[model samples]
Target chain A: MTQTRLVEVRQNVLKHNDVLARELRIRFQKAGVFVASFVSSPGSGKTAFLEKTLTKLRSQYRITALVGDLATANDAARLARAEVPVKQIVTGTICHLEAQMVSDSLQDWDLNELDCLFIENVGNLVCPSSYDLGEALRVVLMSTTEGEDKPLKYPTIFNTADVAVITKMDLAEAVEFDLKAAHASIQAVRPAMQVFEVSSKTGEGMDKWLEFLQAKFVDGQV
Target chain B: MHELSIALSIVEMGIEESNKRGGAKVDAVHLKLGRLSGVVKDALLFSWEIACQGTTLESSRLEITEIPVVVHCENCKTDRTIAEINNFLCPVCNAPTPEVMQGRELEVTALEIIE
Candidate 1:
């Protein structure tokens, strides 16, 4: 009888991505650039939020953004209206932005000149959580129009995220969003998770969110 | 869309691993799949064949060993495997557990190959 051998190969499935992400994190840290990435479901207003954030924060510090999409440069164009440096990373068909893609996209760009960089991932909640883009903070956005049980339905994304953002609060009244229920759901997944409720349209809650971001600066952080 | 990308990584890993065996061919890839891991078993399995098309893992079996989600209860001072995916509370004292002790595995544990 022919015998087959079993080989032990204890390797991570996403090992390559993790290694690249760690390298990126180190590079960003050395340059003193606070990097933040946004992940959300489609039509959750990630672009609008970034647009508002860049506009408000631009005067205080140098900021640039990289927006990812499957096929269009629409988000990149929309964000560039803030008059800050903005680039579009057309993923073609990929649902998430991997660390390698971010690294490649930043080629020839000076990270040390910028105080902060933002990466708006392709609007996908599920796959993006699995791929870390070496951001200092990861923001998971959910719109008021969606059900409060969004966190429960996609616990992985909620669990992986560093912060939760309740977007489009200006429409909360019209949508009848249950704020209490939404908070409870988020807490159920990750207790005491930092949350920000904001409306890009009305500019509500932008100050507090910006304050949290500012606190993450190099001098303020350990 | 990312399932396809993840599938490509798996195939790439499988081929590289198979090459290390000195002409041995891999028949199965043993994986440790955790409940907290974001990858879906069905979706990965569906994309496996397509990703391995004409590659070394074309006919290989993806044997996934599912690991249960475990949490550390602060009150109970115990690490327990959670039965339900959404149950983030301790079964005994009903205290909320934010620390995940296990179940985020995404490793390729072993491979069954023939020389």
Candidate 2:
């Protein structure tokens, strides 16, 4: 019997996921189904916010959503109210959604039938930052009550996001939210990160957010 | 938190790569982790052993080397290591550089197997 010898291998640690993500990216591009994923801490109104946005956009475009949670189908139920197709991904114990999870979840759906897909990832700012889910856009949410230093504390998530959504802005005054400092915190980590302040409850700033989405999904460019 | 999933993928990839290389048993999977990869090296190391437990790569070792965050100072034209974790200021000239030349990488670069 020969003893196994150690070989020096210098490869990217995430090559496997990156390769799968690349394939998914190509697939999404070919089918013209733009995928936007949402990542944020728990209680950040991801489901409610998505519900409002999907309701507005469903008529104009073929939209669908896949929401991941640690246990319940609550988010799927909430988003389904928009009248667009919705699926729930129960991660069991996983904190975040990975590319494999997204790929596996989409196997039953007909990509060609959908114009855009939104994935509401499991609520966690840290775990989701490292995983690439083949999304065209990644929107990270931060509610007013969550604290202004959120961007500074969780720089990884902010750095990874394409846009930052400051949710529940309607409560900004009530909670004495410092909007300027919050924006500055985001800019500190991601200098040019696009920011949108909205209140799903009041429908405030939803129009502009919807318009931004339309520009990307409908017009297909900046 | 997501390290277990990442570790699982690494194990799966190692098995496949080993099988392709004449069914060699994987010994260890080497990884180069960049500073800005946003992955906790300790967490990954802890989860890797567990992730490999029932897989073909059960006995494989995960070797990780931390890579420093290197940025190209356009003004100074020198590749400088970032002193602070997220701040990308050039040490030599203190000029603000927007480009991220290195760090922020998470990829499986290689797999080691015994034939």
Candidate 3:
């Protein structure tokens, strides 16, 4: 029998994705566009929130979006109603969007023309936490109906996210959603994480979110 | 769920490493997995078999070393290993430790091969 020896092959499993993400970050920086990605579980109102955000910000900023889904281009069509550039990335069986997929989708577009770009990842709380999509900010959303313990359950995603948004506040009272508990949960996982509470249906608390986004865009410019 | 893809990447890396060493047969791959890496060890082990099928990495064992989450306690000026992932506070001082010193590691540290 041949002697077995241990060889040092120190390598990152996601190095390929990480390198692509770094390159995309440079590209975004050079183009002067602020990129933000949204991740949440299915039925967390991510699409509705993005639609409202796009519609409100379009007049002041040149914004576009890339929506990823396991199948169908329905979200792209829905977002196109905002009268801005929209693209759909059909990931098929992939649970999350990788940096390569995002880069491939932006090949035909002129990133310089846009002031901000929103990438709505597939509704997966688990897989998307591992892949970095080269976004300057990662916003993880959880609707009031989803329970206040979401952050506690998926601590990795909460820890990795830059900010959190509590959606569907209009139903908070009806659903008896404990806002205090939710805030505590978020803080437990990510200390001092900025959070925004909004209701897409009633447009409540949207002004603060929009203002925050604009401020972040201005910061990215510097 | 995403472990299959991760396993495929590992197999690809193993193949490249083996090729660099005159196509030596790999016996095992050593990996460092962190608690905050969001990868389940058992799921990756199951996916590794499927990923290695019909490849040079077939029949190779995957040895995983799980790393616990570590945080930097600013007040103490030292790193501390937190027992609970959900709570980022320093166990000794009970102060919030926002800066993560380690964890979130997913790397192939070594490979065992037949010479």
- Ten residues in a row with the worst lDDT in model 1 chain A? A213-222
lDDT of 3 by residue, A1-222 (tens): 799899998999999999999999999999999999999999999999999999999999999999999999999998998888999999999999999999999999998898999999999999999999999999999999999999999999999999999999999999999999999999988998999999999999999999999999888741
Interface RMSD values for the candidates, listed in order? Answer: 1.3, 3.1, 0.7
Residue range B16-72, candidate 2, lDDT tens digits: 787777777787777777776878899999998899886668867888878877877
Q: Is candidate 1 or 3 superior in DockQ? A: 3
What TM-score describes the B chain of model 3? 0.95
Regions more than 4 Å wrong, model 2: A1-6, A219-222, B12-29, B52-61, B73-78, B91-96, B107-115
Using TM-score as the measure, what is the rank order of every candidate, best first?
Answer: 3, 1, 2
- Largest TM-score belongs to which candidate? 3
Q: Per-residue lDDT for A95-179 in model 1, tens only?
A: 8888989999999789889889999999988888888788988999999998788998988888888899999999999999999
What count of clashes does model 1 give?
A: 0
Write one digit per residue (lDDT tens) for candidate 2, span A71-101.
9998899999999999999999989887889
* Proportion of native contacts present in model 3: 0.88
Model 3 C-alpha lDDT per residue in residues B7-96, reported as the tens digit of each score: 999999999988998888889999999999989999999999999898778899999999999999999999999988899899999888
